[model samples]
Target: MFKGLGGLGDMTKMLSAAKEMQSKMAQLQEEMDNMTVTGEAGAGMVKATANAKGKVKALDIAPSIFSAQDKEVVEDLILAAISNAQDKAQAKAAEEMQKMAAEMGLPADMKLPF
Candidate 1:
C-alpha cells in the first residue's frame, strides 16, 4: 500500500512481479532437471538420455556393434546419439520456456533468463 507515493506504487508492483517470476523460474529449473529426453542412433543401437537442463543422465548401447573392426563406428554412433540428445534437450527447454512465457502473459518471442 504505497498510497500517495506516486512512482513508488509502480516500483513496488514491479518488484512483486519480478519476485514472482524468479520463484516460477526456480520451479521450472527443478522440473527441467526431472524431465528427460532420449536420442537414438545407429537404428536404435545407441541411445542417449538427457535431462531438459542438458545434462546427460544415461546411455544405452546395443551389444551387436561391439566388434573390433566396428570400434570407430561405435564411437561415432555414441557421439551422434549424445549430440542428438543435447539438441532435443535444448528444444525441450525452449518449448517449456515458451509455454511459461505464454502462461505469464508475456510475448512469445520474449527471451527469458534461462
Candidate 2:
C-alpha cells in the first residue's frame, strides 16, 4: 500500500499510466498497418491504395487511360496517385496519433516517435 512512502503512490500511478500508454501506442501501430486509404489522379483514371503506415498496397488504373501513345502520361498519373495516397496515409496517421495523444491526456500536437 506504500502508506508510509510519501509520493511513492503517485509515482507508481504515473508509471502504470506510462506503461498503459505504451501498450496503446503499440496496438495503434498494428491498427494503422491494417487501415487503408485510397488516392486518385487523372480524373479518377488512376487510383492508389496505401495503408496508414504509408505502404502502398495496390494500384488501379482505368483501362481506358491506357494507350500506346500516352504511356508517359499514364506513368505520370500513376506516380501522382501513389504520391497522393502516401500523403493521405501520412495525414491519417497523424490524425490518429493526435487522437491517441488526446485520449492519453497529452497535448494533441505532441509528436511521439512511432
Per-residue lDDT of model 1, residues 1-114, tens digit only: 756789888899999988888999999999999999999999999999999988999999999889999999999999999999999999999999999888888899998874
Backbone clash count, each prediction separately: 0, 0
The lDDT per prediction is 0.93, 0.93
Which 10 successive residues of model 2 have the least lDDT summed? 105-114
TM-scores of all predicted structures? 0.93, 0.91
Displacement of the residue 113 alpha carbon in candidate 2, Å: 3.2
Q: Model 2: per-residue lDDT, tens digit, 1-114?
A: 766899888899999999998999999999999999999999999999999999999999999987899999999999999999999999999999999988889876799644
TM-score of 2: 0.91
Model 2 clash number: 0
lDDT of 1: 0.93
